[model samples]
Target: MLNLVELPDPEPGDGQVLVEIDRVGVNYADTHQAENSYLSPSSLPLVPGGEVVGRTPDGRRVVALLNGGGGYAERAVADLPVAVDVPDGVDDTTALSFIVQGSTAWLLLRRSTHLEAGESVVVHAAAGGVGSIAVQLAKAWGAGRVIATASSAEKRALALELGADVAIDSRAEDMKGALIEANGGKRVDIVLDMTGGTVTDQSVASLAPFGRLGFYGMASRELPQAIGPGSLLAHSTTVAGMWLPHVFSLPGNVFSQAMGELFELAAAGTVRAVDGGVYGLSEARAAHEALRSRGTTGKLTLDPSR
Candidate 1:
């Protein structure tokens, strides 16, 4: 049912910019919104995308996070605060990756887990947009040993290339045992659990004493089982949850600080934006399917000009 339609150009209100979008970052949340399963209910007749790279009316190229969801089109409106200049060395697609996936990776380590140098960590869906960046950022931030999980060998290889110390098949029957073995017979300090459901509980069980489990997205669409407080207390482990929408809704300079750190890393090449696939704007349905299929690696993007 995806259709391209003609609409009037959006006018920029105060503190808003009319951006001519060149590329848009395809995200799992977009699929959630489309299916009406997103935690934050998007209004009806919504244009389904949140991040894009575009030029403002005055001709400044920028990466923008569209709070109102219009990133699927050739033009969209962006708030001034969330819009930042794309670095000279970065392309539109890479820059578009930074606004959501990049910052999410940064926040998982920097804010939620407070991961320290030499701490062993596990990242699920390690070849994905956020997980790919997370793998790089974990190394850059001094993680001692990073273990990643992906469905395919190619994706696992990509995770290793991105800086994961070890990569394991996520569908392994003995996932917890595999993670333990990967950490050298010891449990990991942190688990960045993106694929909720059963994985969340397993991640909690795989934690070392005083470990932290940082749960974010539930791309698996499986109902997450609850973690028993007694079990966590026995191991002195903590389970922390983060939703990007909640992070973005916070007041003060939190969003800017997190994004600034990620952008700096991207500019310096300490972290790279992994490119998975690209599709024309008119092929948005295909883009969403690609995102959900788990058949692609890196960041998926949409080119309006294509």
Candidate 2:
């Protein structure tokens, strides 16, 4: 169904570039789009992908973010400012996953919360795409303790292997208690939450004084509930909503510098690609089903050549 219709080749107007896509990262957003539950609805029969790793017409490897949904097919057009040169030794699969998930993790740890060495962070959904990258990035940023939450034993184990100091079964355990115990009885300095609903309350409660809670996704399928009146005042906690596109929209060289740092981390192996599955572009429906089932542990991608 994904390739039933072909999209016309996009032209680069002004400061834009047209890329022949190689691999497209399949994110939770793609699943949401496929189900028609995404934050922003796309036009019907729209191609469904946000980021792609491909080559320029001249064959320079690059990674670009698409404005419209056009990454599941052959080619896409992207703004030059948001596009970055893929580092040497980074393949298409790794580049596709790194553009969105890896950059978000880097911005959240290094820029958003200013996470410092010896501080602690708790990342929800630690086995998924963004979660897995966030786990390793937190450690690379010198976090003293990294606590991760997952629903299954296998995922919890994966989180530990990826650099988490502790992994708790969020579905069956007291998340707040486990986090506190993991941090030596002190509240964590930051909470990276993609899961919303009741998990927001737990994350708020888990923050230390002056701690920042970074919210990026709603994987729980519910809006974040309001915090109690006294809770915010008592804890002096701050909630930050992060959108990677917005981060890249800044003026000057902000976006370029950030992407450069993230690419460096990936090249050095401090941050690893979490692509757990790869599917042909025509199997997009199956990919969305797998993502919605919540059984997949890491990032998913589509190889257009297939």
Candidate 3:
């Protein structure tokens, strides 16, 4: 269903700015859109992308969020508010990292958890697009012990290099046990579970009394079992889910402030975007395959000028 076609350049309508894209972020959400599995399904004839870093007509470099898909093209139209100037130190790809994955990490750590110093946290898929950023942000925000879970040794190592105090193999036969052991032989204070299904239960069980687990994605493509009151009666734990699309819908300063903080963090070198690779725009198929393989780390970008 992925194809490359040539069309006339698109013009920006009211409240929209046409950007000459320099880098386009390839997100797992794009996969959901491609398969019509997204919470907000993509309509037919969609272009299939969400984030991009580009320059406007005035030549101001900016990172833009495009909900309706169109970033894969050489030129993209983004809302004026969604397109903001990139800081001096951040590159195009790193700037693209902010709008979705970076902001999501910010929201999860700053708004969702209110994580405090000396609190232990577990980040599943810790070397992933969003997970990678989450790991760094957790450490920057003063998480006492950061536990990361990944499928491979390299990924676990990557997690460690990204400020994780402990890195466990999520595919290990004794994953839960290993995670608990890494957390001082007890459940952690917080769990960032992007992989649902069995991990959901494991994450809940891996929480300490009054622990909190934030559920965001289901990259495993499996449905998690329902969490009943009985599941948390003993520990008094809490599990909450977040959909970024909905978060962006709220009208207020909360969204803008989070994004501003993300930019500041990147500028301060507290967190940096990890590049999996940059493929030509025509190589979108290969890009999607790389993402689906679950073998890539950090962020993958598409360059239309290649």
Candidates in order: C-alpha RMSD to true structure:
1.3, 1.8, 1.4
- Summarize candidate 3's per-residue lDDT along 137-227 as a digit string, tens digits: 9999889999999989999999999999989888766656777899889878998987878888778887889998888888888877856
Q: Point out where model 1 deviates above 4 Å.
A: 249-252
Ranking of all candidate structures by their TM-score, best first: 1, 3, 2
Superposed by TM-score, candidate 2 places the C-alpha of residue 57 at a distance from the truth, in angstroms, of 1.1
Please give the range of 10 consecutive residues that has the lowest summed lDDT in model 1: 244-253
Clash totals for all candidate models: 0, 0, 0
Q: What is the lDDT of residue 91 in candidate 3?
A: 83
Q: What lDDT score goes with residue 253 in model 2?
A: 73
For the record, the alpha-carbon RMSD of candidate 3 to the native fold, in angstroms, is 1.4
Give the C-alpha lDDT of model 1: 0.87
The better-scoring model by TM-score among 2 and 3 is 3
Query: Distance (Å) between predicted and true CA of 47, model 1?
Result: 0.9
Ordered from best to worst lDDT, the candidate numbers read: 1, 3, 2
Q: Give the RMSD in angstroms, all C-alphas superposed, for model 1.
A: 1.3
Q: Considering lDDT, which of the candidate structures 1 and 2 is the better prediction for this target? A: 1
The Cα RMSD of model 2 versus the native structure comes to 1.8
lDDT by candidate, in order shown: 0.87, 0.82, 0.86
Q: Mind sharing the TM-score for model 2? A: 0.93
